[model samples]
Structures are given as C-alpha cells and as structure tokens.
Target: PTLTAGTVKGNTAGAFGYKNTITTDNSYVVGSNSTISADNGMVLGNSATVTGANGLALGNNTKVANDNAVAIGNGSETAAAG
Candidate 1:
C-alpha cells in the first residue's frame, strides 16, 4: 500500500505536488513533494528524494541517490554507491 500524508497549500505543484513518489514496489513517501523512485526506498520529509533501492532519506531536501545509501539530515545527500 502507498500512503502520503501532508498539506500542499501554496506549493507550486498544488495538490498534485505529491508526484514522483513510490514508483517501485514497497516504496513510501510521507511528505509533500517527497519521492521514492526505487524499490524498498523511503523518503520521509518534505522535498526529500530517494532514487536507489534500499535507500532512505529522512529530512527536508535530503537525497539518497545510490543503492543501499542513507541520508538523515536536511539537505544531506548520499554519494552514488554503485
């Protein structure tokens, strides 16, 4: 199951701002504009992005761009670990 819980008021993307999320199986995005593009990935903060399988991004603007990577701080990014 997929779940997204948040407010998108005044966001440029509007209610549709919750795009690009959970494209793969078992992925989850819990905030506005967060994205989880890989299987088993998770993005739990506003505008966070996770593009790698098993990756996790937990703060605003955080990004986990590589497989098995994790980013836990606001605006933090994980290096490509391929």
Candidate 2:
C-alpha cells in the first residue's frame, strides 16, 4: 500500500471493508466498493471512501484522517482510545 491504496473487499467475516487489519501504510479501504488514502490508516465499508495520509474508511461510506488511525463504517475518524 502506498500513501493511499489498500483494499479488503467484501467477504464474510466482515460485511465489507477491513475488520481485523494491521500494518503501517497510508490509506486502507476494506469494502466491496470503497476507497482509501492515508498513511498508516484503515477503512472498512461497503461503498465508502477515504482521502488523506494515515487515514481510514470502514463502512458503506466511512472516512478517516491522521496516521496510525482507523475508520469503521461508510465514513469516520479514529478517536483516541481510552
């Protein structure tokens, strides 16, 4: 994966997008129809998209931002874990 290009299309374990992803890239899309672009990020969607270094989109249209983060479902943002 480059600064924005990682796909994990639909399957079973995950309705779409990436469910159990792990790595250090830029962007990552894990859905049947989604897009990602970031640095060390992840996205999981059915038809979503993401744009940015270290971002992620996960869902039908999720989106993410920042590095070492992750988005789940269509669009979103990786909030600091507690």
Candidate 3:
C-alpha cells in the first residue's frame, strides 16, 4: 500500500519513487530514496538506509548495521557490540 503524506500518529509514506512494505512501531523518518528495517528506529533525510532492529538513523546516503544496531548520517555508520 502507498501510504501518503500526513502527520500520522502511526503510519507514514514511503520514499519518493519507492515502496513502503516494512512495518514498525515507535519510529520516525522522512524524505525520499531511503530505506530502513528497524523496529524502533528513526530517520529524517534523503537516500538513507538501514537493515537492523532497535536502531535509529539520520542524514543522507547513510547505511546501518544489522541485528540491534544504530546508524546515523551520510557516509557515517556504526555497529553495536553484538
């Protein structure tokens, strides 16, 4: 489903020219051409990406670690002690 724009308290839209399929709880994100797979993570920018749980992300063209990691910023990333 194409979740459009809104200050929705629960659901949000996908990035521009993209699709939003993953579902999560307690997270925030914005912008286009980005990705995330966090259960309680957040992002607010363009071309950002992540594929982990309980993580948070921000900035443009960024990547995150998997398995309970937190990523932040473009070309800036990190991983947790898992």
Say which candidate scores most in lDDT.
Answer: 1
> How high is the CA lDDT of each candidate model?
0.69, 0.45, 0.57
lDDT ranking from best to worst? 1, 3, 2
Q: What tens digits encode model 2's per-residue C-alpha lDDT throughout 1-82?
A: 2223333332321223333333334334454555543344455555554455556565555655444556664345556556
Candidate 3 similarity to native, TM-score: 0.58
Lowest-sum lDDT 10-residue window in model 1 = 7-16
Candidate 3: deviation at residue 39, Å?
A: 0.2
Q: Which regions of candidate 3 are displaced past 4 Å? A: 1-22
Error of 2 at 22 (Å): 16
Q: Which ranking of candidates, highest TM-score first?
A: 1, 3, 2
Candidate 1 lDDT at 57 equals 86
lDDT of 3: 0.57
CA lDDT for candidate 1: 0.69
Error of 1 at 82 (Å): 9.4
Q: Which scores higher on lDDT, 1 or 3?
A: 1
* Superposition-based RMSD of candidate 1 using all C-alpha atoms, in angstroms: 7.3
Clashes of 2: 30
